[model samples]
Target: MKAILLIGHGSRAKEAKDVFIKVSNGLQERVKSKVYIAFMENATPSIEDAFVSIREDGVRYVDVLPYFLFEGIHIKEDIPEILREMKEKYDVEIEFKRPIEYHELIIDILIDRLKGAGICI
Candidate 1:
């Protein structure tokens, strides 16, 4: 089976974690495939742990979606390295997707946020 692993750069703040979980939950509901969430650090259910759970569920493939905004070290180096190890260890097909880079929708969202803030954008 195939699954989705949404990776978030976890924060020490509870609110950050809460928001990630909320997004994950919403994604889970909208998608037919199994969806799981993990954090890079400062959070529970690390990527490795999530992989173990996914493997246990007999998921043969995983799409690793990084919930990040840029191609930082974490997106370029850290995540790919970890995913390589996980793929070998779990014997599963893993695809590391790009981060949330520039997109027209992002501009729309920014404009909406500015308007919501009464900035008259």
Candidate 2:
């Protein structure tokens, strides 16, 4: 089976973890694959750790999706660097996916989130 490693920029707040946990759980059910949530900083389960765990779970193919808003330095440099390290370490092949911000649905979701949070559009 395949695996998806949802990598987010980490935050100290439990509420922040809640957001990623919910997304990871949804993905786990929807994709029917092992889903792991990881962070680039300030948290456990770094991208490397997630890749290792997924590989150990018998997932030969892994796709890493950066849970970021844009192609900033973290997306361009840090994430790629981390993926490269993961690729080198893992015996199986791995693929890296683009950020979710490119998807049209994200805008719709963000608008809905704004509404849910009682923010005026």
Candidate 3:
């Protein structure tokens, strides 16, 4: 089965994990793929370790979904660094999925948040 790895900037708050889990849970159904999470820092399941676990779990393919809102250091550098290492280390091939912002629907959510905050639309 295909696998999905959701990569997020790690947070110490339990709420962060809960949020990631909730979102991942919904997405799991759509892809019918194994979904796992990793944090960039300050949380469990570092990307290197996650990749090792998935590889050990016999996952043949992976689509790494970055749980970031914008293109930053992690997206531009840190993630690709780890991914490159994982790719060479793992016998199975892998793919890093793009960030979510390419879709315009994110603007809808931002607009809604602004409206909720009493900003004039």
Instruction: Provide the TM-score for each candidate, comma-separated.
Output: 0.96, 0.84, 0.86
Candidate 3 has an lDDT of 0.86
Summarize candidate 3's per-residue lDDT along 52-82 as a digit string, tens digits: 8898899978889999978888899989988
Q: For model 1, what is the alpha-carbon lDDT of residue 105?
A: 100
How good is model 3 by TM-score?
A: 0.86
Runs in model 3 lying further than 4 Å from the true structure: 114-121
Each prediction's RMSD to truth: 0.9, 2.2, 1.8
Candidate 2, residues 14-91: lDDT per residue as tens digits?
A: 898888889888878888767788999987778878877887788877778888888889988988887777777886
lDDT of 3 at 42: 91
Q: What does the lDDT read for residue 41 in candidate 3?
A: 97
| Top-lDDT structure, candidate number | 1
Task: Please give me the total number of clashing residue pairs in predicted model 1.
Answer: 0
Q: Which model is ahead, 1 or 2, in terms of lDDT?
A: 1
> Worst lDDT window (10 residues) for model 1?
112-121
